[model samples]
Target: MIRIVSLLLVGLLLSCDEDVLPKPNSFLRLEYEKATYKSFDDKEYPFSFQYSKDAKVIEKKKYWLDIYYPNLNATLVLSYMHVKGNLMFLLKDAEKLTFKHMIKADDIQAVPYENTQSKVYGKIFEVYGNAATQIQFHATDSVSNFMTGALYFYAKPNYDSIMPAVHYLKKDIVRLMETIEWKKEEYF
Candidate 1:
């Protein structure tokens, strides 16, 4: 009986030797609604483009617009300037704005865009890192119309956290740039 009891205790001790570990940390999966786009055609403005219906276009001024994405807590600040022999200045300023984030950005990729048929030409700068602005772009007719846009989030700079939203909005920005239509000189 002593031998049997000792064997049973050893078996019990062996069975209980397994380590108890806390559950591994799990991450939240972020998902956003499917995007739909709408045309932005205001005769009052010199240009028109298509933007995601998910965003609201608030006219900050005569030629300035705030494309607000409420669900994502982000905004695309767009400003328009008549070339008036200041095309170089506008382009330089747009590039300057993009490079301002170089300290925090791992890389700044400038994607050149040109639609010869529409006379729309520009460069879309993609800033990778924990920068305040993840995207910046400038479009110009090289003669009459120039426009610049910058993407900004309401929260602190967290690249990993905001990457999804940035990618989604980046598509929208590219769509807007692709669909840009400059009104006739007489319309201005």
Candidate 2:
């Protein structure tokens, strides 16, 4: 009886050890050390932004840039595209070509623009908590259109891990939108 009880105790201990340990929080923490900006001379137009040193600028096309904002535990991706021509026309083209694709992919919902002309400035939409936002701002001369769009996604979905970094990076996005200077030369 003593030997049987000892074997039972050992078996109980082994079973307890087999129980899996709870995993640590998988969420990542992001660090926004500093702000950096860059512009490519090879393109027909000039584009600039304030970004983190760890972030990468991916050139998808001659005129498009995919700015990858890296978080210690999340990802923030923004795409900037510059085009010249009728502002309304370019926006429509983007809606059909780009925005529609996102909707089809179930990344975003199909929403119409809500035009607003406030005392400060004219904004087409008041996108709230959106996964993405596209803006087509006409140049001061109204001769060209400057388009910059951003796609926001949580890489880890841990709000605690990414919110701070995202908040800091969003300021850069606002700065880029407010300070866009389009090139005078026409590519096409």
Best by TM-score: 1
Give the alpha carbon lDDT tens digit for every residue of 1-188 in model 2. 99999999999888785657898867455565667665434454454334545567677776676666555433333333444556676556555544443432334333332222211121222122322332222122234334535445545333344446556755655554444544544554
Residues 1-188 of candidate 1: C-alpha lDDT, one tens digit per residue: 99999999999888886688999988777887777899999988899999999899999999899999998999999999888898888899889878989999999999999999999999999999999999999999999999999999999999988998899899999999999999988755
lDDT of each: 0.93, 0.46
| TM-score between candidate 1 and the true structure | 0.86
- Indicate the worst ten consecutive residues by lDDT in candidate 1: 27-36
Q: What is the lDDT of residue 50 in candidate 1?
A: 95
Model 1 lDDT vs. the true structure? Answer: 0.93
In candidate 1, position 33 carries an lDDT of 76
Please report the candidate that would top lDDT against the real structure.
1
